[model samples]
Target: MMYVFLGKNVAQNRELAQMLTQFQLEFELLTYDDIDETILNFCMAHTNDCFDLLTDRLQDYRSRSDISYSELCQLILSDVEKHIKFPLVIKDDVVYAGLTNAEARSLLLPKKVRFMLSRQYLSKSYHVMMARKKVS
Candidate 1:
């Protein structure tokens, strides 16, 4: 039962969740709020504590080169380009993926379900933490 997740802002979320429920689909939901917090935490950890700290790091890296910030970003992404993949999650025993709006609603419909789903979702690398389940 693989599904893909869509944001709540998308009308698709309401349609999909209702359709999935009517069909009695067994799945999970992952909300954007959870994702946002994780991203915020990561940014805070990666960013410098202060402007001076950031400048120092930038100066150290550009001591010899005259690369612009955009160029530096491109260099970073070039390195990241090598490691992109689909996301998935494992629970009790089943593995789920292709997390559409419906599936995410399943996970988010209930607080307990959402917590468990988020925990498992968080355990995996965000680079590939979708709930893609293999069909039985």
Candidate 2:
């Protein structure tokens, strides 16, 4: 299966990408500049609110006095890259945004296990990665 990864050129994003690579998971990486209307629409459709697709860092931007929550949401929906979050992982119909290592591990372990079993019965050594996705 192919996954879509949206993230910036930051340490955390890089680390997550590396972990996914080590798992032999195939994915397409998209930076802020690469975000487009189609991707935004997919994210909005899968998440309850567009903000649910953003990173914690964008939470601070959402709290700014100049913009209301709705306005911030609008900006995100409009694909305002700066207001968007980093390290977003989309697979099947699920979208994972701003996940920690532990969180990513929890989410990925099951999938990785499934992949390994699908390939070979051997128990392979694999690191744990965790993530969270806001699904309705």
Candidate 3:
């Protein structure tokens, strides 16, 4: 269970780290400055995959798009098992937790969790490139 948390500040971000601790969730924290091109590229790929789905979800509900991460933790705390499988992106309090997989069964999972190629391929490609770089 890998949780990648993007915190805006080191001090401000501790709440998430603590919450994860309270729930015994393992996570890596990254601030805005820590986002390199590679990480951003991977995140963007995920974002792009959910763009249309997000638009559709937004259309269905009356949700405040500008929610906070603290609030998101509470939501996840309510149903950890349901939210545990996928990575989370909680920006402005609008939580998109594995929407493609959660909303549709076998929708983006097979395509995404492959070894190489297709679906959200950028993250895999990035990892491959980095591994090759390290090996050499």
Candidate 4:
């Protein structure tokens, strides 16, 4: 769905572009000058949401440098997780296809989903824990 071409020279980059002209892949041209604070913020917020923000934003960064996309994604995840503490286990592994709600249920069964919130009232909820499967 996404193709990244990071070349050291104009000729090489252009050749890659020409080859991909018909594939209908989403393509972006990135250089050192392309990044700004807005791009950094976008990367941070979206990375927290899906963990693919680096893949979406740093394709060329990895290509131009020695790093691979997987490494970049890991680095981004590490940096983001440092700032937040939540009760659920977070993972950055790529799921070939997106997980459906049923699949998520199956995966989390026998496991508990925990929340850190603590409040006295129903609306403000004290911590919540989702215990796995139960027999009737």
Candidate 4's TM-score: 0.25
lDDT of 3 by residue, 1-136 (tens): 3434443334434544564465444445444334344433344355444233222323322256665544543443454433333334434323344333233222222343443434447887889999999999
TM-score of each: 0.25, 0.60, 0.32, 0.25
Q: Of the pair 2 and 4, which is ahead by TM-score?
A: 2
Ranking by TM-score: 2, 3, 1, 4
Which candidate number would show the highest lDDT if scored against the true structure?
2
Model 2 is weakest, by summed lDDT over 10 consecutive residues, at 127-136
lDDT of 2 by residue, 28-103 (tens): 7766666666767777688766667775656666457988755655667565555665567677778777667667
Instruction: Name the weakest run of 10 consecutive residues (lDDT summed) in model 4.
Output: 81-90
CA-lDDT, candidates in order: 0.43, 0.64, 0.42, 0.36
Compare candidates 1 and 3 on TM-score and give the better one: 3
lDDT of model 4, residue 63: 41
What are the per-residue Cα lDDT tens digits for candidate 1 across 1-136?
A: 4233334345655666576576565656554333333332343244343122122333355464677655644443343212111122333333333345556567435566667767877778553544454322
Give residue 102's lDDT in candidate 1 (0 to 100): 52
RMSD of each: 15.6, 11.0, 16.0, 18.1
Residue-wise lDDT of candidate 4 within 14-95, one digit each (tens)?
5545544533334454442333344434444444343333334434563466776455545545553231211111123222
